[model samples]
Target: MNADIKLRVSNIDKSFPGVKALNQVNFAVRKGTVHVLCGENGAGKSTLMKVINGIYRPDAGEILIDEKPVDIKNPIQARSLGISMIFQELNYIPEMTIEESLCVGNWPRDRYGRINWKEIRKRTKELLAKENLNYNPETKLKELTVSDIQMLEILKAISYNSDIIIMDEPTSAITNKEVEVLFQKINEIKSRGACIIYISHKMDEIFRIADEITVFRDGCVVDSRPIGEYDLETVISQMVGRKLENNFPKEEIKLGGEILKVQSLTQKDKFEDVSFHVREGEIIGFAGLMGAGRTEVMRSLFGLDPYESGEIFIKNQKTVIKNVKSSIDKKMVMLSEDRRRFGIIPVRSIKENVALASLRKFIYSGRLHEEEENKAVKEFCEKMNVKAPDFETKIESLSGGNQQKVILAKWMVTDPDILIVDEPTRGIDVGAKYEIYKLMTELAKQKKALVMVSSELPELIGMCDRIYIMSKGKVTGMLTRDEFTQESIMAYATGTKIQKEVK
Candidate 1:
């Protein structure tokens, strides 16, 4: 361990053509300590981390490793400098096996530089075991779930014998059990004198694992304090610049006519015998463990997947939602679980993306209503409080939270009869998440029904008017607002609830 500092980044400045991403940013990480980079989305957290890990070269300022300045021009150079970064959007070769993906950059070669398949698999298997990840080394990345592929990425960084590891929203797409395993691995690395920069929007995690907390806002450091100096409320206020008096603003919703009613919605092995009713002015929550098929059920309902047989009713009238187009035609919209994969279109402008699903509504014959569309987008952007250069700006430039807002804007523009949100607040920050919850509340107030699927227990319990627990592709139990409890939900979700208590 260096007596002075393990890593120092001073007055760092980075810009992306027109946008000044980072401004006079100062950051440091001590050896063998967990330093959390805390901030709302697009507060230059990612930019600063990229500067330190060599993804982006700073236009100004210096990065010092062990009291000496160094130039990290590329990822290879960064790896050579004993630095590794795990990005929020994971990078993996899906066609290759786990071992093959890990050994791609620098494989164990025989005397003639030929590939040594036997040694490669052996070492990869042993390394995974040491990290306590149970999976076949030869398992194809495509065959593995998204969570397992993420574990492989982490192991790949450790394989480089890195001393400094930067993790950005590492647990965003992971399961609860996988998170425990990751924390254990992080501790092992810390014990060996490694510095870890943990970047996340979840304040609970920062307080739990961080030695020091640094909050960033608008491309500058707001506070750099020891972990004990902050609590969840204090940290959230610093990050979002507000007191989170009420996280969920769910109000007493009046029961109204049924907006969506599904009868025997079955999707074969994924989810079977699923039946639920969502009334106007209510939030219906679907709760389950990671692979209990909660998301699958929602997707099936939204016409994103093929269902064997089912009948969907809207306003007491039967409708056919054979495909995504038909679903939208029926005035039903879905916010997907995986944002990058299904939710937002990265390459298009914010206005274009938000107005995509319902473009035909504004255009007549061969002409388009440009003014009306802009006015609509402007109104939605204001309603959602989206921060962006312009509605014409590309969706990729905004932070994860803002991108989510754009998705919400798009669905809201469509004016759906029933809204199905799957992991609506997956990677959004605290303030933005609360805003989304409020939006849902207001939508319910407008007699718009919502069916939400979430992994966060508090979210389901706090935001939903009613909760349905699913297990192994079946609806094990349903709980009303009065009966909602973590223990009860878990018991039902795991097939341990009595038949009589299910009602």
Candidate 2:
């Protein structure tokens, strides 16, 4: 109950159908300190954050603000009590402009009792400038990229002037440079005596910014201690309820002939003269910084984007893939990086989503085979270890990792020979990431070609047989396993060393 304690939750309990999300959880944060929460997906970290922010009222618990017991019934109430949050999933009005979204609930008023448009623009410009973002105040929210939106949300939380700030995976979609800027801002906020409850699955960030560490496992608090008291191994062991044997369980598969080849692929301003190839039973990686055209090239390859001049060969045969259907017909599949936007249908059941592309296989006698479709969906979901109440549940109800698993199920149902996964583990926990890596390895062993695009260089170095570094719209460097290094990749990604020939 000391004043130095900025926020506290005692005996917090929350539950949903078929899941006890939180069980008598206890957490506290001191003023000016960064308190980090680490846990596997569905281990009650996100649920706890929701409870603290009043999105979900604890079934039995007490919340204290500066040692004073208070009931927070809604997010508005939590904000009024000097609480602000940056959610992992964006919750902004896409139809609105950046200025409008930032000014939500706290718009400056004019003397004539009207919304102050000019003041809103000024504040938005100031916030953008503070973060070194080059976004127009009048730009629609939907027009901004994922990283830009994340930076804007961080700026919004900082502008709240709150005593307690909850950041849920704030750096998940940002670049390393952006993360450094965010850490600097966090230090500045700490100097002003604010409490930051930081939640993330990334160990490096946790160790860098956390003053106190709390680990959650299976809805219970595993341990809490000073950051110095916990090593990386101890933290990982506590998070998954067991020691993580290997972060990347990559399998060495027998090499085969090229399964996919692209020559002189040009997507106008997005990417130009892009060239790459993936061989059977091999895992190829595309490594680059943001805006380096990795995703753009993948989109073109998957037929989600149009290219002006390019030649694509599938299994030594020239093909014209002008749309997703053609790409699928050619036995190629893609898992989009932005799952919410292009991967899953939120309102649809898992069965429908999983069987979406391969529904033809379930049709017989001019009728839809409902039972067969359900059976196929179940098979793929189980193979991916998708943890959900049932296939009947809506896709949106699952956690990010589980949703990602379902997407994998959805694509694998197509029985594609070539798989392209973009940012496969962007927002997933370490435990789930290991599972995904295992799945990718299994696919490789099965002779399915894979092209994985990731911004994390360590992931490339860990799981890839070879890496192709992209910069500005070109493939700058290609490295074999022995040639892989973070420094070498960055050198090519930043155009410092582009002497390596394109493969």
Candidate 3:
């Protein structure tokens, strides 16, 4: 029963109609320790977390606090019992102030049931400082950038005085600077005798902050060990049930035709002089740390953002693309990094989101072919292995990995010649990541040019045929399969050099 454990998730099982989301999962978090949860997609990591945080009630098993059995009925119940969670997907009222978000459901009330504004603001201010975060409690969420919103979520969790905190890829969208601040805050919270259930795919971040590690694979716990008991290789093997020999495929393909060539691509403050050429059947990886203007470069290239001076060429012929429509017309599509914000529609069904970009083909004179759309969605779901009861299921109902698969299926259905996947497997589990990697390889086999922007160094080395390292809006160095090394990429990404030749 793990009597000393602050939170014990015992023999939990949960399922949807067609998929067993979680099966007999047991997890625990010791008091005042950073317990990391590692798993491949479909492993039930999120489901287990959802159970603990009262987002989902398990069909079987019980959760215990200090060796006593307790059933978590809802989020409020979990919070009342000193448990809080921050989702990987951010959800907050954009127009609301930071203080408003922190004290919404659990607001301090006066004798007559009136909200105590003074007390709320004071608590908000104190919590933000505890993390060394510099944000006004009155700042609206909408006005702040993605990084700012992430920090606010942490502050809100801290403000609740939660004993156990669950952070699911909390730093996925934040910049490197912001990530440093987040790590500092996490350490501070740990020092203050608070427990954190850290969930992330980023190995460095996991090792840096976690006091102990637990790996989940195929909806089961593989092992739990002290943080230093295993190195990256061992930890990864435990997570996936196999040692990862090649994180990147790094296959050699013939450069028969110049599929895409950018000449002097310039987007005012985003990116400049971003000139590069991608050949048919080649995989070009745009490698950089967070905030290195990688996504900006892809957006500009895809015509989603306005570029001041850039001549794009397809098959050595110049063309002007000023918007998303033109880029699609040119057969180049982007699988956005921010899946929730720019990719999937939460309210829409998986069928609708997948068929969105190319709806015209399925529509005739304002009359839609519902049968055709349904068939297409079903086929794509099968092809991508998107596990759901049916394509009619709301996109939000699917797990993170399934949602990601649906997005990839969306872009692939477009049948584009050039595919730019910005962090395609960012928040997914190890199993899902391998599937994505295989999909990318298949794309290369079909002679389609691919541009991948990734934060994980191993992924870049494993998947890319040739890697271009970017640092602060500029190309720093290019590495071939043989020269694909993390230190080399980090050296360039950190701006230790302008441009260097790799031997």
Candidate 4:
């Protein structure tokens, strides 16, 4: 044990009924440095972090903080010992105001032992302002966007002023600019001699902020070294256990007739006059900055949100889609950007979640054919390479990547002609991302129309046949494959340049 070491774990082992989440994992973090944890989803990075943060008690291990043994039996104990964690899953009281949420754990008290509401509001306002978060403290958290909530989570962790801060996929839902701000905050924390344990699958962030890097695979440490000792290839190879030749294995496909079209879709203040089309076998992309109406447009198109006026056509026939079932009946399905909220049913089993959207196929003679449903679920799960303990395993227990696979499988079983996938690879690792890209390319080869909405520019450029750039509730520019560059896309996204046609 070194005096400079802020946190240390020796031979930590944790397990659940069917999974050994961590196997004799040993790791150390030095004060005043950022230690990055990189691994594929289900690789036990989160599990290890949970053990350290007291969310999960390790079955066997010795945890030492500052050369002293510590037993962190719960989150409260961890926090009391100067440890804080920002979870990947957004957990907050939706009904609570921003100020109430931020001041929940540590509230200022008056002389009478009651909460000092004024002081809390003042402090929360100051905190938000310092972070450049232009949000009202009185606004309920449920009213805020996902990106804003992500920023708030970062702020909440930073507010603790702890000795050790653990952040899991902090930038998964945020924009690049917000990520820059987060990095700056992290650096400030580092300057104060605090230790940061950052868990992310993003290579760019790993390279930018990590002082030391540790790779976890299959619930064990594969490698741990300084940032200088590893390149993107080495880190990725260790994480995925193979050389991924292409993160985006996009294949060219022949264009067919327009399968779906939206003309002048308006959602009052949400989005306006949004028009796009997806041809059979063509992958169309929607690229924009955060809150640029890309998601709103997709939501309206899927009938998740009501639009003031719009005309939707399927195979050149005007169709009125009143709800999700209506859209599904028309052979259209959507993979929402916020998967936790909209995509998966967390409390359900793997088989049930997979068979959710396509239940019609399993229901015969006024009953669900259990054997038939199970067979179909098994086939699709295997096809998607979903890693789960069993068909009965809870969907919430699976890793982020596997959960995404199940969601994809859910829609795939529906045999949709048009798939509107929003942020399909949001929080998953590079390996899982590659798998999804391969799947999308396969779908395109089958002449299925796909519309992809992504904040990641390179993904859109690599996978999209054509891209429509949205800015402030309108389609600012449309680019074909030849013109699909980050610069051109940003030009339209930021409203610096707008092209009228899709050429």
Candidate 5:
């Protein structure tokens, strides 16, 4: 064991019923450095992290802390050993106050052993202040946005003062400014001789924050080297085991008649007077900052939320979509940005989740036709390139990318004319992202109107025929492909410049 090594795992092997999650894996992290793990989804990155965090027990492995072997039976034990993890999924209880959520395991106590609410609030306020979060400590988690919850999770993990911290896609939902703050915090942690084991699919984030890079594939270690020794191309090739010629496989498709149109969509305190349209075979993007009302607009369009004053026209017919069913009936479907919350039925099997929305298609005489439903699920799963042991497998067992693929398959079963995808490639690896882009291209080729909401500027530029930018609940600018640029998008997104409309 090296003196500088903070944590090490030897010959780690883990398995599920039909999956070999980790195989003879050997990994180590040194003090005062960011060690990044890069791999495709279901390639054992999260599995290995779970093992370290004691959320999962390895069938065969030895974990060492400071050169001494130890058995970590659970998360509490791991935390006690100065090991903390910020999970990819936000796990805070929505009903709990920020102060209570932050002090879950280590609550401050008075002389009589009662919880000291004053001390808890004081501590939470200080922590929030240190992170530059302006939220009230008494605010409930349910009131916060996904990005806000993500930032709080980071703060909670850091508050543990751990020697080894595991961050899995910490920047997946946060804004660029918050990402900068997170990077600064990472540097401060490094200065204090702490080790960081980071897992992210984002190439830029990897190159920017990593001191060393380790690539995983099929539950095995492929390569580990210092950041200086690898470039973007090399790291990506190592991750997917092949060279990717193009990150965005956008295709040209002939535009057809306008299929969906929104006029004067307004939701109080959310978004106001937002107007956008997508023609058949056209992919229109919504680009903006985190709270710029992009997601809110999509939610409203999909009937997941209400818009006070909006006229929705489908194929030139005024359609009233007051709920999700109405939206679906109008040949429209949405893939939400928060997949776990709005997209997936986690406890259900992949087949069930896929067939959920389109169950009517499989029902014959008030009974589900199993054979027909199975056939459709199988076809779409294959079309989406979903990697799973079986359709009967629980959807939660699949990786984030595979889960997303299943969700896409779910909506595709409906054969909708309009598809609204929010952050479609979020938290997925580069290879998966490429596949999704290809799928989107294919969908456009099929003359299905696609409305994409994404924070990544390059993604919108590459895939969208035109983009609508929003800032502070207003449509700031609309740009065609030729005008798409990060500088221009940011100018619109930040309210530095605005255009009422662009055609």
Candidate 6:
């Protein structure tokens, strides 16, 4: 064992009923550096991290900390050994206040053996200030957005003051500015000789902060090297086991008449006076910062949230969508950004989930036709390339990318005319992202209108025929495909520049 090695796993192996999640793997992390793990979903990156963090006991392996073997049987034991993890999914009690959530497991107690409210509030405020977060300590977690909750998780992990921090897609839900702040904090942690094991599918973030890179594929490590020795193309090729000629495989389609239009959509503090339209055979994008009201507008349009006042025209006919069922009745469906919360029934099988949205179609004589449902689900799953042992497998058992595919298949079975996809490719790998992009293009070719809300500018520019930029609950500007650039989009998204109309 190397003197500087902070953590090491030797010959680690783990398996589930039908899946070999991890092979005989070996990994090591040194002191005071960012070690990034890059791989497709289900490549065993998270599984390996779980083994080190004591979420899973490896079937065969030895774990060492500080050049000595250590037995980590649980997360508490791993924490005692100076290990803390920030998961990709947000985990927090909705009813708990900020202070309570920040000091959840290790609440401060006074001499009387009672919880110290004063100290908790003081420490929470200090921590929030240090992170440049401007939220009241008494604010409940339910009032916060997905991005805000994700930020608190990051703060909680840092509060542990652990020697080894594992962050799984920490920036997946945050804005680019927040990501900058997080990178600054990571640098500070490194300065104190703490090691970071970061996991992400984002190429830009990987190249920006990583000192070392490890690429995983098919439950094994393909290559590990210094950041300086890798390039974007090389790393991507190693991850998917092949070269991708085009990351965004967009296709040209002749757009038809306007299929859906929204005017003056208002949601009080959430969003106001939002207007946009999508034509048949066209893919439109919504681009903005985290709190810029992009997601809010989409939610209202899809009838997930109530809009104060708005006029919606479907196929040039005024339509009123009061709820999700009404929206679906008008041939509109949405794929939510928070997949775990809104997209899937985790306890159900893939077949059940895929047929959830369109179960009525499978009903005949007051009974669900099992043969018809099975055939339909199997066909859609194959078309989406959802890799799984079988359709009977629980949806939660699959990787993030595969879960997303199943969601897409679910909505496709509904045969919607206008599809609203919010952060469609979030938390998935590069290969899976290309597949999603291809699917979107195919939908456009089929003359289905797509309204995409995404924080990633590059994908929006490549995939959308037009884009509408929002800021502070308002639509600031709209851009055609030719006018789409990161700088121009950011200018509109940040309210630096605004155009009343683009004709």
Model 3, span 312-359: residue lDDT tens: 998888988888888899899999987767788999988889999878
Worst 10 residues of 2 by lDDT: 243-252
**On residues 5-83, what C-alpha lDDT tens digit does candidate 6 reach at each position?**
9998888899977888888888889999999999998898888988898999999989999989999999988999999
Q: Which lDDT value does model 1 have at 407? A: 89
lDDT of 4: 0.89
Q: What's the CA error at residue 230 for candidate 3, in Å? A: 5.6
* Winning model by TM-score: 5
lDDT per residue (tens digit) for residues 91-208 in model 1: 5556789889888777789999899999998988888887767888878887876767776777677667688999988888788888887898889888999889999877677888
Worst 10 residues of 3 by lDDT: 243-252
RMSD of 4: 1.6
Q: Write the per-residue lDDT of candidate 2 for residues 400-469, one digit (tens) a residue.
A: 6788889988988888899999998877888778878888899899899999999878889999999998
Estimate the Cα RMSD of every predicted model relative to the unseen true structure: 2.4, 1.7, 3.3, 1.6, 1.4, 1.7
lDDT of 1: 0.84
Q: RMSD of model 5, in Å?
A: 1.4
Which tens-of-lDDT digit does each residue in 275-389 have in candidate 5? 8888999999999989999999889888888889988899999998899999998889999988877888889999999999999888879798999999999998997778888
Candidate 1 C-alpha error for residue 312, in Å: 2.8
Greater lDDT among 3 and 4 belongs to 4
Q: After superposition, how far is residue 317 of candidate 2 from its true place, in Å?
A: 2.1
List the candidate 6 regions with Cα displacement exceeding 4 Å. Answer: 109-119
lDDT (0 to 1) per candidate: 0.84, 0.88, 0.82, 0.89, 0.90, 0.90
The better candidate by lDDT, 3 or 5, is 5
In model 1, residue pairs whose N, Cα or C atoms come closer than 3 Å (at least 3 residues apart or on different chains), thus clashing, are none
Clashes of each: 0, 0, 7, 0, 0, 0
Model 4, 164: alpha-carbon shift in Å? 0.5
lDDT of 5 at 242: 94
Error of 3 at 134 (Å): 4.3
Q: Order the candidates by lDDT, highest first — what do you get? A: 5, 6, 4, 2, 1, 3
